[model samples]
Target: MKKVLAILLAACMVVALFACGGKTDPTPSADPTPTAATTPGGEEKPTPGPTTDGVPLGKILEGDHAGREKYKIVYMCNTLAWAWNAAIADTLGKLGEPLNYEFTAWAANNDFDAYLNNIPAFANQGYQGFVLGIDDTLAQASMEACLEAGVSFVAESTTIMDKDGLCIWSSVQQAQVKNGGIAVQWLYDHWKDYWTDATLDGQKVGLIGLNYSAVSGINERKPGVEQKFAELFPDGKFFDGDLAALGTTGFSAEGGNQLSTQIYSQNPDIEKWFVVAYVDDWAIGATRAAEQQNITDKTLVVSIQADAFLAEMSNNYTGNVYVAACAVSSTEFAIDMANYLVATISGVATPETIWPEWNDAGGSYPRIQVEGTMITRDTYKDYLAKQAAMLP
Candidate 1:
């Protein structure tokens, strides 16, 4: 009825607060100062968890708070099965002990009732902050509940907006349009080399965009790639496997492989393919499909999040079809959430205060988008070295 999965996803974040730990042993980066504080109810910091050197605040903030005086708070989010979510969850697991944070991550498994129930459960259980990635339409009641409970809140992936088309809370993640455009820029510069024997009239070159339209953060990625492809190759043929439209989760690499296989199979003439995927898993799927069809040399893929790409040690560009990926740096994003929440609770920053960038840009609610960066096989080693230094 559906597709398949290849994730070695840990059960860590599939449940509520304080349930599990990360697979990593990340230590905190050296700090100019050591942190020592308690949560507002005089609760202690340093919960039982992994150690982490924090990403460092620009300066020791002046106050402990959002409007109340507090040092730290419990942070939670939905879903750990997804790589991005898992990375965030792992960071939470590591940072809590050193930074005085109480945090957890897990999925609701698409059960809306179970998802909505956590919002109230979090408040009832004394949690003071959350980074939620929820359905926009279903967010109002939960968002209202968080506001009423005085929970410092941040939206993950997409900003929670009010009925009047205004944002209600700060959001974390990349600018969707720009994130997609990264794929286009890479494809525009590189597609030609891959299209050597292909011809537009012969229907040999196909541009495929893998769509995950269910979430605004991901859905917004498709248009940027599509619009750019049209302008650059006016006669090009583009195809899609809109997973949301097809009523699929759009996550599994195997699903990606199956969907892309169908696309390539139907258009047998499409020998040179360029796949722009919203995430790494789908991109890997498309790459696998190209390999299976023996067109690896003529296919190229670019997507957001280098999670899977980093796991592969081969020369991903020359040795494989998947070429590039972008990262929101799950580590950095997780740290920013902690910093912003503490800054708000300690009275140094307002709910509208733009973190990391420190400016609201005149928006009612802050939409803090981590700039995305392209990573290729050529540079993954450096990225890995940096990760090693940070974690060790």
Candidate 2:
């Protein structure tokens, strides 16, 4: 809440998760090369031409209450081939009905330069609005392109930050600080069932926060949990794992597995592992590695956005290894973002009136953040019931 926008998303790298944190550097430290990631589960995306190929540009999903002017918008993300982005696309597509707009789901494939390039590509092509799942390194340039074209933008998964690394503008992302802090507290409270404070303070357990240092959006997921952990266990030996080194698409389970495996192999003195992650794919991957190593007994992982894992959470990734997650409805997220983008573009809402209240916390931006629910194996049904209520 100090400086990053947190609201309205959870998926891609399973993108669309809550993004909170500052922009320390314009460029992320990871390699920008596009790699394959089969998560959130659907078909795979081709090297995103950022074109109309897999991207369903100008496609209109059937809807109701017509007679309104239709505008073109784009949901530019890492890839559409994966399930994470696909569900969001479907939800965005449906907004055409009562909201009255068409869209192109541009799969950018984690290419930073491509974001710079394609903003103009589609802007010149008459795309009037954009919902981006990207970092703020290029926020200035991206904003410039939109300004030139008279295009409106609403950020998802990633908040657009200012030159000062403070959040700026409107975004729909997760509650990074709130969720991170709460998850740590939950993990700590649950851990009390088996371990004592002296044992935790004794340095027998190690903490790992997995992230791609380059993707500032996903990195937001860590600070909340890390801050809470530091307060609880001052001597906690926390390891920050850079999944960028694994180099699979930004947030893949495979990348997480490789990173956690390395962490486990390298840290021999640690008796237990507690991992904090954002996307379900990465958490699932980390859980896979922990289970394979037979360390779930001592290791517990919690993550945000259960969309990717919900399909199979009951059958797999059960128990305390992957433990709990914060679930947000993709349908609900897209609806909120689509409405905000169109409303802002159409002048139906402004910076002053977009959010219901100004005192609401979401960094320093005009954010329409969606709250998430924490669910465990014991409360999966409750989440499902809650998820069902939001169905279109």
Candidate 3:
């Protein structure tokens, strides 16, 4: 009986040893793949979502209007006989169908009274939208008439006061101001060290003001440069004492040539000449005048608005022509306004004002401020390529 009890105790001891060994090293099972072990500080990272730089998705989605009915819009400009008119016509043509709209242009040929008289005529013709490239003097009354007729009105490159709910103003990216400031800043950055210190101190920068009678954009741009120069050089002489006025009408080149000739004749010592004109056509005229006197090299010509011809000249002359910046045509803004009108007619929330106050710093607007490209001879090829890419 004692031997039988010993046998049972020995079996119990053997079972206990097997159990302890299994906990330390278990036997391999049918599925022998090892499981992944978690580390002491293991963590699973989450995936990232999408993002835009700063523009809200709501603003991006705001102006979309699909399957809307067609609408008729009349675009009025102070002078319908120029490149600007062509730009407006082309822009409107592109906006057709997609926005369901047709634009008719009424050019007043720079006559303020004629522009005012044509408003009611256009409204009577069943037009719903009116775009005005107005003379500053006629803005208030024309805007008032538009409000009275319940026709939505938009002004390009200018604004009229006292019409809060009636008018939308498209602000071109202050191209005139930007171009002027850039030209001056370029001179300061690149050529200031070259000028004799004494000459640089008293250097006279002459501004050739164009369309003094009718052009508002040119007028605003001149003051921007003047103010910038004042800020940069507190005691610098801004040769405002010399003013050469040119008309944008027929013979703009001739007018530019005549004015430039007069300026050179009166103040030959002027070192830098900043032209406040719409295009290189005026600069071409000034170049002709400089050629007549064999003085092209003496003057540093800085002008706004660059087309194919101006771009080529900038390449050839290098430092003589100095800087060329673009004041992109108002045509794109006209197209945007047409699209906005279609959206508004379709009951979408549209801006009451064309040039909203927020767009002063290149912000949002029905009439967004389109910026100009600044080009020098070194950068002309790249500028041309970019403009070419935008064609289609």
- Top candidate on lDDT is 2
The residue-by-residue lDDT of candidate 2 on 1-392, one tens digit each, is 63333332223323442221101111101111111111111123342222211211112222332656788888877666545567677667666555677766776666778877888898888888888766666666676666676778877766666676555666666555565666777778787653444356447677888777766666776887788888887777888887877666545888888888889878879887888776677787888888888887778887766755565565664466877776655655665577667666666665445643321344444544444566777777766764444434
Candidate 2, superposed: residue stretches over 4 Å from native: 1-65, 81-84, 111-113, 165-168, 192-201, 314-319, 359-365
For model 3, the run of ten residues with the poorest summed lDDT: 27-36
The lDDT-based order of candidates, best leading, equals 2, 1, 3
lDDT of 1 by residue, 41-155 (tens): 2233442121122223322223222344333344444455667767766665665654555565646656767767777786787777676766675567667777877777776
Candidate 3 similarity to native, TM-score? 0.67
lDDT of 3 by residue, 1-392 (tens): 99999999999998774433221111100001111111111221121111121211111123343445567777677653344444555555555545556667666655677778878887898888776667667777887788788776666666554444322343222345655565566555655433334255345655554334345655656665677666765554554322233334323667766767776678866665554444445666666677786765555455555553343564476445434444353333444456445544554434543323333333334323334445556565664554333222
| Per-candidate alpha-carbon RMSD to the true structure | 10.0, 14.2, 30.6
Candidate 3 clashes: the total is 4
Better by lDDT, candidate 2 or 1: 2
Which one wins on TM-score? 1
Residue 29 of candidate 2: its Cα lDDT? 10
